[model samples]
Target: MRFQNLMFLAGASALALSNVANASDLTAAEAVQEARRAAAERTAATEGQEIVVTATRSAQPLADAPATMSVVTGTELRRRPVQDLAEALENEPGIVINGIGMTRRGISIRGMSNEHLLTLIDGRRINDALANMAHADFDLGWVPSVAIERIEVVRGPLSALYGSEALAGVVNVITRRPSERLEASGLGLLGLRDGKGGDTGQLSALIGGSITPSLGVVAWGEYRHRRRTQSPLSPRESELEAREALSGSIIGWWEPAQGHRIEIGQAAIDDDRARDTVTTGARPVYYEYQDHITRAQTHGSYTGSVGWGELQARAYRSVLERVNERDQNQTPTQPTKATDTVFDGRLTVNVFAGNRLTVGGEHRHETLRDSTVNTAGKADVNHNALFVQDEWALRDGVSLTLGSRFDHHPAYGWQTSPRAYLVVEPIEGLKLRGGVGKAFKAPSLKQLSLGYITVAAGGRFIITGNPDLEPETNTAYELGGTYYGRSWNLGATLFQNDLDGLVQTNCVEFCGVRGRERRAYVNVDEARVRGIEVSGQVTPLPALSLSASYTYVEPRDRSKDRELAERPNHSANVKLAWQVADATEFNVRGRYTGKQTIYQADVPVRLDDYNLWSVDVSHDLTRQLTLKLGVDNLFKKRLAESSALYSFAEPGRVFFAGMGANF
Candidate 1:
């Protein structure tokens, strides 16, 4: 790691020297003018009502995609004081952000668990090996909303193009890029939040610029500190936890020639101590946890014309490290640490005859090491896959897509998935589409190794490894239609997914020593989930916009005769935004989540339905400065996005105020 850092620094220095030597070739003023021109062209291309999305592994108009998709642009995200991608996605149709305060959280789409949905950053997966068993939280806290270019959410099965875990869908986060010429930009924010616990402070800053026509770079950092009080419903009673985090990222890009690009980026996050306490008797026992994570990735791509088709190739490598600490004076257990690295590549071609072909492969290897005295162990796993897809234009107004994938895992043998989709554009502004596909997720190391323990019977525990666990599979189908007009747009989708071999742990009373229960992972027979989503945007006035979405889900575990955990049957969101004047705007947003059932430690818990409201106002103070204010959970509703089946809680009402500037 040290050697790599040294080499990167040396390479950057060499490039800087070369740029200085060639300074006479271009002047700063000329570079600025060229950058303005490029920016103008990009702005014009994206100014219409039509939105473009690449969630299908190919760039296509959102209206033409067979599945449901939502596009959230940088402008739309900045309407409020959003901290990360999860916060920005809260209002999107058929998507839910189950945030657990600050450190840990998950995203659920179409009534599926967070692990079922795949998240990608610029087409590269964010490795989270422990997500299935414990708190394997992805560090999205460091990804500032101001640094984002756009975000695309694809609903329904996408395993044919994105690989196994995308049984539910995919969320692709695209970061901003520097212009071809010289330009500088900066943004800063300050905010305070008042909740049940107390008040919290937030600050963030971003600065970026292009050094030359072919070289550009961006750097940003943010810090948030708060002392949060525990809710009344919390089982473990304690004072507010003092939370603080420092996160930052730097990205550098090089475009030496036309149709070629290279990028290197690194991100780091450090969090302060968070303590949870439970009173057993006269003294209170505490569980202290602190997490630190860092990730680095590099990618390069080339595109050009080959024969009658356009061919493109891309390759990338990423490394992630996470260190977790759990300490208690009574229990002298060591901390845990894990590291993961991933490499992937892809090749795609587009023919002039309205046919697109895509082929790709991916390899993932992970290692986990535990240091606790009573639970010291190590495990390694590897996975490889190959996939191909082809889209053919059946006619001037009709298209068909066919694709398949083969995946091999160390624990699970080779598995194949196939998919097919059709699109019919009966008219200029209207289209109908449908698709069917299969997807699967391999078992995690935790599920295969860690033994179950019971604390009810004098802390007696039983440990066992299951080598016979099978992979979970899903067969899904979807049908949707979309209509686009000059100022109005609408989309609707109906989908169903049938699942098999779901991992479940069984515990019977007095099954172990001292009347303790035994637990083991077993494959369940079947489960089914069906849902409908409808969303639209209407512009009644030139300066005002109204958007609304509603989703309904019916998820059940046929084998257990119970509703799936953490899935709400009904949910909806409505938003109204108005440009009151050229320099001022106001917006209001509200969400409703229906009741649901959750299972924890073999017990079922029910959560009541709730409604949340938020409001935001922003004003341009000057040509280079802006001010914004927002209030989340305006009704102060105490609602749980997910059941206590997990050891995390959703936050309450928060107030924010911030400002940004261009220097």
Candidate 2:
């Protein structure tokens, strides 16, 4: 939360596109009104794309930002041959990436899921999906694809300025910073398909400069290995599940004077997976498993300029741990844990002229420890929040954005969220936006401190926890439209959300006291969702580029009246890129989904509808080096029905190649 300064509050630069390379979160008078609305949009006529600053944390373009974000860059993540971030957002727009088999542990936006979004990297919030009780969300697999430099998602509910799970929005990856003159880079990758044992390997590196002139330093590291799974899965596709990951980060910066600035960072990650020996029963035993995850982070930040305008602050410390080992062939249990810790702070100001304001606060602490139950004891959760925002300017084509936040849980004690946004632009290049928000979701810590007890056969079952659970809200609404001609651009949006008190975990039998049977975690009363989105992009000549998107959702569940388990009510996305000459390049993408419904033991099941395609080609073996080739799914599509819970297997057609270098 720095928002240095730029300017621009009238029509808030109605975001669209222009050309930018880092640095934004405006402040100095909204970066001097976004450098005079990007020099009056470079005298019009399309000015060839590039200016996109995370919807409106300042910088705008991307058709003056209508808040349905998407961005990849880092030069399209270094020439895209995707790897992580759900395969670079599986063709963007309304995201999916859940899994049929190609092994995507999770991803689901617009249609919800993935714990209702909210993942940030340089904007804090970290917890890399804690898997247990079969939640199975590997959180974008092993990130670190050359230390990203872009990947912002944002769609719906910003919890008035980001609070609670953002209700289903916010992705924010944004790595790669620090490089004031001296710089370094590296990338090594290897992948192969068919020919047995798939194969996958990668290594990454980055370093930054400056040693005195005010002190500065930066570093990055990544390591990955895979011995199988480059798409292809069939009842464990030849011993599937052999993976390894290692990650690193280091940052330091200081400025003992001038406008003042400071930063500190540390990051670490280690993930491992292995599985093979499968057989069991009739004495053919074996069955194996291994999983280990560790995460550690430390942070510090501060941007100066007090006396009344620009100022930013941040603080962080995090640790996430997970370990699971399974053999069960004879004996092998014990090892399942989840941990979390966070603290944040933010402040921004302008207070006049178009009015700018922001305030922040957050605290989180969580823990989950399972050794396969022991009457289940010890589970924790503690969270607190406070937020505010404002960005006036009700004249010149209009502009507005209000905010609110107040969380405080202890088994749901306070909630309060609010939001509002509006942008006009009655003519010139069209643009109209709207917003209404509120978000919530809290009640983990094993559903408020769970405790178990089992026995079965007709009694005994006793789960636990639910210190009076509550906290599930959501109340969203959005409307959008954008148009930016000259070359082409179009967008549309209409959203709805209305959830409330949802929690779930049932059971009551004889009401406790000896008769046992009383499970826990309740409050699942209502639900509703609605959606419609459309997007477009075009650039007929000068090297080609076209994009498309469509979405129509209707997730319902108003107290069990229907749909909502696995979402998917229709989705689409298409992409194409070309520049096939000097240095060469080509890209293609396609996605479609529809039909989905779940409920195994209680009936209702229906799943079908699929389509996925991908292709990437690139070259630039000089001026810093780059080469890429790709294919993912490319028509191998999967998911021919499988229930009793789920299993779709979609990840087969595989082929890839990559190379990189820089200095």
TM-score, every prediction: 0.84, 0.31
Q: What's the lDDT for all of these models?
A: 0.66, 0.66
Q: What's the true lDDT of residue 208 in model 1?
A: 68
Per-residue C-alpha lDDT of model 1 across residues 306-414, encoded as one tens digit per residue: 4544445555555555565656654422344445556566666775588888787777776655532125566667778888888888898798888988888877778
Q: What is the lDDT of residue 406 in candidate 2?
A: 88
TM-score of 1: 0.84
Task: Look at candidate 2 and tell me the lDDT of residue 168.
Answer: 80
| Candidate 1: worst-modelled 10 consecutive residues by lDDT | 452-461
Model 2, range 1-663, lDDT digits (tens) per residue? 011111121112212111111222224554344334423333232332445544445555555554667676565555544446766776788876664232335677878766777777766777645323344445564357676777778888776566777688888787776546767776655555444554565667788878878888888887766654422334443334666777888888888987788989888878776665443234455455676877777888887876566666677766666676766543433555566677666677888777778787778776667744435545666778888878787788777878788888876677888888787878877778888888887756555554543333223355565667777888888898777777677878888888888777677666544445576668976888788888877766656667788888898988989888778888898887776654566888889877778777668888776787878786654445555778767766546433323443443566766566666
